[model samples]
Target: MLLLASVMAHYTWLAIDNLDDVSLQIQAEQIAENLQLTDGAPTLRLPENLQRAYDQSSGSYLYALIDSKRNILIASEDKARDVFSALSAEQLQRPESYFRLINGDGSGAPYYVLQKTLVGRPDLHVVVAQGHLHSDVYIDTLLTEFASHIGWTLPIILIGTLLFSVWTIRTSLRPIKDLSDRARMIRPETRGLRLPTSEVSDEMLPLIQAINTALDRFEKGFEVQRRFTANAAHELRTPLALLTARLDQLEESATAQQLASDIERMSRLVAQLLLVSRLENTTPNLEPGVDLNVVGETVVALMAPLAIAQNKAIALRRASAPVTVLAMHHQLEDAVRNLIENAISHTPPGTEVDVWIGEDGSLAVRDHGPGVPADLRERIFERFWRGRERSGGAGLGLAIVAETMRAHGGRVSVEDAHDGGAVFTLHLQLDKSAL
Candidate 1:
């Protein structure tokens, strides 16, 4: 800022000096031209005709002439009475054609000197003197007075600009602040929250829409969880309560044993329910998560005793090799358990239930029993769906598997196996690194 101010001041001064120089040069030329008509040594005589003409004019120039050596020849008598000394030749040559000389007599008005070189006589110089260039001094005086008035007022303008900037920044961020507030209000208890979009800036509209979409998904999941809990309680609690009461009333006998069997069945149902409920909440806790092949084996171990009790042969076929995936432990186990259970229940006592892991991130559990009709195969995964004449189990196994697979970013389906048996296949997305 200081550099710029200095440049501005210097340029202004140069411009004003140039104006004076040009005026001085013009006056000097006119006077010299009139005086040199005799072609003698350069001289200046303010002729009467010229005097009268200039006297009526509205200006303050006093005409003069000078020799090339820079000596004054003629001066205005009114100017000479309060005259200042002659101007230096170098100063007279300024591009602006104006020169200032302070009066030695203390009475002369500040004056600008103008000199013009003679055309024919190289030794002659013509000049004029005019009133002090007063515009700059007048402006400076006005600013001095103006500064006194404005010194205390500048701080007010600065404070006003700062306050306005802060208000603008806050108002501009109001929508974002509101968005955060709405997000904070969303919870399991109040999951219906949707950020308002009516006043969103165009640049933030995508984020607003995405948040609303996420809220919609959250609401749906919460509803599903509520329904699952209610239905699971209704389905399992009744049989268990009845079985427990019967056990309490019975004595030791075949009838008592039958009650125990019923209790066991009820316990199995409750266990199945626990598996499904866990599945609903399971998600990968880490990136590049556990492999499904390992999950399938763990499930096979857990349910092997039940299969053996039913006189069903359970086996892993063809090196069900490592099936890599992104999965949470309990969720993948749920999907595997459902398929293995389906295989065990549907197969003949002697026929093997084969769980196969495929090369393409797929798992299949096949049972060599009467297969599902093609029409019903797709519906097998629907909650509580049971085939005609299907029995001995609640119809939730396949549905639970489907739900678990879907939650883990995968899917489950049923189709005919190579051996004309029903095969349930669960497929899950694998991380690229796992593959």
Candidate 2:
């Protein structure tokens, strides 16, 4: 736009200058037509209007007549005579009408000179001079005023365009923003849900549809996996019960006792795997609040007999005040029970396994036995993982605890206890505001 404006201004200036030149040519020709060469002394037969204009003595108009010998014959003003006298002989020899611009050196107003050779009088000529400062001032003034207005108008137009561009860009991207927000809400439970396609832009529709299709495949795969695990666990239950009954008939023997223990361990492993499958396929049930202190005390009590049978003791170090957490009762209890069972297994005979419920809603199970090595602490939570030196049970206890914690949006960590034993801590969401 600026380039276009500059081009327009340049052409307009040229047109104005050309028009002024045409006006000067016409004036000089009119002056030449009114000349009379009587007795070889040139005289101007001025019309009433032309005589009045030349004799007006205004700064804008002037006229001078020059003889064949290059001597000034008549001049409307002394300044005109002086300017004509100053022109070189060669400058005065033009065959056609011409105009010249002169600069004022502060002595008088700057002016333009128009000269024309007389038609019949061969050597006679007429020259018309006018003050440009008076005649051409309006044109220069108008151009400057117009250019100044353009200067202000262009910026306003550009700024308005800039603001409109920003609004347009943001408005155009609104659909993508909505798509991102909807994508974040998808979890395993909500995986079957689809993104709304009504308002999606045509340009983005293909990508969004591709993502929805991928999600469909993922949900189907997850359903197949969950069904397989649940069905296999269910099918094994009755046969395992019959096997237990058969083993019970001869369980008084050492071989029968060992078979029973192995069968029980296998049953626990199936239950743990089933729990993992179910937890992964669904969201945690957190409608009813459960107190971690109550859950911890219950799990400690349940594991107390097993600990005592191994010549180990289980104790609950409850918090001073109840620590309420946002978790389902059974799931919370399962997590705490697994931790206690793990502690008791690792603890030696005559040692105590401590279950501590913190006021901040964290549960810690400490065993006074060899602490888990730093490098193996995280690995111990993998399914079917056991320490290098450990034996006698399925290795899903810690893994079950980890999965249960995940279902509750909680965390489980193992660190060295003060007694040089391993301490497993379960960090839960503390519903202090509810309490």
Candidate 3:
């Protein structure tokens, strides 16, 4: 737009200059036609208007008639001398009629000089000059007025176009945002649902269809995995129960004790794997408010006997007020129990494991044992991944805790305690009040 305005300005200036020059040319020719030759000497036969224009002292028009031998025949006062002196000697010697722009009267002001020799009197020349200062002022004034108008109009047009573009772009992208919102709502159970393509653009349809195809493949794969895990876990339970019964009937010897421990470990792993499979296939019930303080106390109580058996003490701390969170009671209990058991398993003999429940609906379990390394903290939550120094029942304790927390829109994080052991914190959104 600026470039366009610049072009317009330049062309307007050229056009005005061309028109003024042509008008000056016509005026010069008219003056030449009015000249009368008598006895081979040129005499001016001025029109009424021309005579009046020459009589003014501050007139912009000036003319002169010079004959052979450089004698002036008729001139407008001393104006003729100013024109003659303003020209170069070579310019004065020219016989052809031509227009020249030059500064005359020694004033440094530009004038248009039209010099011509008479038709029959070749040696007799007539020179006409007009001040260009007023014409220049007129052109400048016109451009200034044009620029002022364009300055306001162009910005308004640009601003309107910018606003229109923003609205159009935002409106055009709304369908993509809707598609993303729908994708976010898709979970294992909701995987059957598909994204709507009715509002999609032709340019984006291919990509959207490809995503839906991938989702279909993922849903089929996930269903197969869920079924296999459920079946394997279910199949292991019968033999595990039979083995436990056999171990119980013959358990007074060292071999029997070792076998019992192995059985217990296998049993716990089977239970955790089943829980993970269930969690993967279905969303947890979140319609109930469970007091985290109660959950923490219950888990501590359940693990107290095991900690005592290992020569370690389990302690509980609770806030004055109940810390209620949006979660299913059994699922929340399972998560808290896993954290307590994990702490008891890691702590050394004679050391205490602490379970803290806060009014902010948060729970923490800390063990007085070797803290996890910084790099391994996050990896501990992955299923079947354990620290090199750790011994556990298939490393599913923290994984179950992590999955449970995720189901409740909560998070579990492990950090080093100030007193040198590892502390695992569970952060959950507090249920302010039950509906």
Give TM-scores for every candidate, taking all chains together and pairing residue i with residue i.
0.46, 0.64, 0.66
Which scores greater on lDDT, model 1 or model 3?
Answer: 3
Write candidate 1's Cα lDDT for 1-435 as tens digits.
354457547755665546666656666666765674554654556678877755754346676555556666666655532443446767545333455655556554666665566666556555577776468654674465446754455577668878988999999899899899888876543556688989888999998899799879878978788678758866887778777886878678998888787677667667667766655544435347566667767888888897899888888753445667777666677668877877888888878888887767777888988888988877878776778455567778787887777666688877787767888887877767855
Candidate 2 lDDT for residue 280: 72
Q: For residues 293-379, could you state the per-residue lDDT of candidate 3 as single tens digits? A: 788778788889999999999999988887778887887788888888888888889999998887777898999878889989889
Which runs in model 1 stand beyond 4 Å of their true positions? 1-254, 281-289, 318-321
Residue 17 deviation, candidate 3, in Å?
A: 14
What's the best-to-worst order under TM-score?
3, 2, 1
As a whole number from 0 to 100, the lDDT of residue 130 in candidate 2 is 67
Winner on lDDT between 2 and 3 is 3
By the lDDT metric, which is better: model 1 or model 2?
Answer: 2
Assess candidate 1 and give its lDDT.
Answer: 0.69
Ranking by lDDT: 3, 2, 1
**Candidate 3 residue runs with Cα over 4 Å from true position:** 1-152, 165-167, 177-194, 248-254
What TM-score would candidate 1 get against the native?
0.46
Higher TM-score: candidate 2 or 3? 3
